[model samples]
Target: MAKDGRGAPVGRRVMLGVLGLGVLGAATGSYVQNSYDNLLAQISSRDPTGVTGLLPGGGGFRFYSVSESIPHRSDQDYKLTVDGLVDRPGSYSLADLHAMPSTRLVRDVQCVTGWRVPHYAWTGVKLSDLLDKAGVQPGAKALRFTCFDGVYTESLTLDQARRPDMLAAYRMDDKPVTAAHGGPVRLYAAPMYFYKSAKWLSGITVTDHVEPGYWEHYGYDVDAWVGKSNGRDDDPTS
Candidate 1:
């Protein structure tokens, strides 16, 4: 077993056969900070075949970061840019986001890999609020999300992006999101599969058409509805 920063056992790393390499053994604790560090190493060293999704979260939900290593941005340096086909394009600092009215929602998180965390509470500004502030231009059909992580991207149709359930999330389960868990801020598309909620979210661009996201480019569905998009019939989380 690999121990965490506080010397708690983080269970074991599951270096299974090719189809399941880099998965993690179930470990639970609120104090095991280094578990994410070990799991992040495993992710960078293997394929993205849903292996990282198995890494345990001390707070009940699992953690997954697809980058070669987790990236960090201090709150002082972090900014979210909203642009493309918009009239009032603008950049917002972390403090700017915090000043916005907050919306909190309790929704289920369904990962494409067959894991579901029901009733996860997320707190953030509504995506529609930002889009409205930017004054979306005519002919904008979709919204694309780019991450500070450098590799992850996700898109949603204009209608989907404006839904009340969609948010630019800054907190999860009532706590400020940590770096290992896509901190500073992330997107939360409550009705879509978890992947649609891009982590380390940095940009929101209005697009003329639906662009495939990172996983979608790798054959996952671009419109990742909870149970309908990816060939799985699990119950819808929204």
Candidate 2:
């Protein structure tokens, strides 16, 4: 069984600060409250436990990042790069992605760290669809995802990337994805553990083989299907 190095002890001061901000947000409900949400995001960027993630984030989903901070990208500045083994190499802005065809899915989001958020709504362009548009090369056998945070990366086999359930999701919770939730765009691998779905998605580079993601390098399974990998016997999310 693979055990992750995360879940380290966070500070009590951080929790107390969050709680205080939550009270302030409730009491004020002004710009300060909005700022509180942003402050929580800053705190959660360094939080491996996802405890702060459940507080300000929209869904029950918890936030975790390998980077020192969560990145925020706007429509004008955010771009998803498609390159590597593809015939067409280019970047797509948030507007370009929003104009493309979108598929909606409602599925249980199960995390490897013993958390479950059921029947969450996800909407985005299918990964296979994006690959087709980019014209994957004959030599391509895998996909490597790089995030805007500059630390996290994930990979999938070509067959797995082509699954109908795999998506480059731009929307969740029936609204635009917030930065804490992986923001303007993120990967949604419905059949796998939530960690397999990389957040703050920035680049999708087609490759000839799969490279282990950050967690995978730390003894997590590269193909982290729910209830299958990590030696857990929980209900299958797929």
TM-score of each: 0.75, 0.75
Candidate 2 lDDT over 1-238, as tens digits, reads: 7577556556777898899998987788756645665677568768878777556342356668889998989868999999999889999999989899999999999888766777889999999989999999898999999999999999999999999999999999789988999988999999999999999999999999899998999999998888988987668776
Model 2, residue 35: distance off in Å is 36
Q: Model 1, range 34-82, lDDT digits (tens) per residue?
A: 4664555556456456565555432245667788888899999999999
Task: Report per-prediction Cα RMSD to one decimal.
Answer: 12.8, 14.1
Candidate 1 residues lying further than 4 Å off, grouped into runs, are: 1-59
Question: For candidate 2, what is the lDDT?
Answer: 0.87
Q: Which stretches of candidate 2 lie over 4 Å from their true place?
A: 1-59
Question: For model 2, what is the alpha-carbon lDDT of residue 150?
Answer: 93
Residue-level lDDT for 78 in candidate 1: 93
Residue pairs in collision within model 1 = none
